[model samples]
Target: MRIYAVINQKGGVGKTTIDVNLGYGLAKSGKRVLLIDLDPQGHSTTVLGDQGAELTVKELFESGSKLGIKELAQPARVHGEVVENLDIVPSNIKLAVSAENLAARIHREKVLANALEKVKGDYDICLIDCPPTLGVLAVNGIFAADRFLIPVTYARYALDGVADLFGIISTVRETDEFNYTIIRNGYDSRTKTTNDFIEGQLEPFAANVAKTRIRKTETINQAAINAEPVFTFDAKGNGTADFEALTKEVVGLDA
Candidate 1:
């Protein structure tokens, strides 16, 4: 299966939003999308609508090969049958502890990749929502994935993140690292800062920048609060349109 990690060393870039929404958008195309929350924050778990997805990534690492995708994954938390094709491996704060406990072993890099091997065939795509730091767990995440898809916020400091994430990518690729792509996440055309970021900065680092820029919209933000996707919440909004355009570039499908 093709796996994409939605990652950035910096936070507040709408990383989780891109992960859940893109996974949901892919699912709408009839692709079976599996989303993994590698972040310790459990935002993906909450966003997926699994109130008690109580299983965290920490437990998975501790339990080793005994853990199964069915045991770890919860159906994404969207209203209606819109999420029928979506599944999620939830996460929580404890993953940070797990990372620390497992760091001594060189084989730790393959832990997540090994865990995912069990159920990789069931999905057309797997999206890992990584934390905002270049820690051990995030290293395992990059090591496990087939590709990288970065989401950048429309802010001034956003340009400062490329060097760190790129350094990690180079380290991973020295092994069996996968191909990478970078997509601009939350964009507002009216903002000069956003324009500066796109033209003056991100254009140099992004491997695959989609033609569409996810605009700032309350509907997209509100949909997250409602624990649903913009497509399911408001299909006509700019958020849905931008992501739909992104999916086309992602899978080369018309859905």
Candidate 2:
């Protein structure tokens, strides 16, 4: 399976949104997708409306491979029916404590990698929703993922923590293994400042930026508020189209 971590050190960059939608999009295309919510905030779990999962990522981390990933994963549903080929390993506030404990353990960075190795063959793709900081949890995600996806907002300040994230990834794996993509999120085509920032500041990373930008839209939030993916909520909306395009681009890239 191809595993990709949707990460950015800055919050509110739409990392969780991208993860849920991408997983949904890929699953819609008949690909088995597993989304792992590594963030203790559990925003992904909230967005996907997956509740009452007895075994969360927190428990999986503590138990390691003893509790198989398949057992820990719960189907992600939309409109009261399980979405085909989509599953989630939910996370909750307890994950923060697990992450702290992992920091002091031996082979800490490889903990997540070891856990995922046992069940990697079950899914076509695995997307990890990372925390908004470069901590032990994020480090675990980086090591487990084969590729990284950084979502940057239109604001220039959003680029502030890119270097720190890249530095952390470089230290964990080889330069070649640092393969990643930058997705421009919350984009506003009407703003001149956004255009300038993309052309001047973000131009250097042009090759890595996604061809399909995630535009600012109320439809995105509405779908999340409804606890359904954009495709299930509004099939013809831009939100659905954007993520579908992103999933195609990601799946096209070889792991």
Number of the top candidate by lDDT?
2
* Candidate 1 global lDDT: 0.79
Question: What TM-scores do the predictions have?
Answer: 0.90, 0.95
Residue pairs with backbone overlap in model 2: none
TM-score of 1: 0.90
lDDT of 1 by residue, 1-255 (tens): 887888889888888999888988888888999998888887877777454556756766773447667688777766534368898887877777887888887687788888788887889999999899998788878888777888877677875777778888788768534566667766677787557756677656444666777888999999989877788889998889988988878896212
Q: How well does candidate 1 score on lDDT at residue 197? A: 53
The count of residue-pair clashes in candidate 1 stands at 2
Off by over 4 Å in 2: 63-65, 174-177
Kindly report which residue stretches of model 1 are placed more than 4 angstroms away from their true locations once superposed: 49-51, 63-65, 79-82, 175-178, 253-255
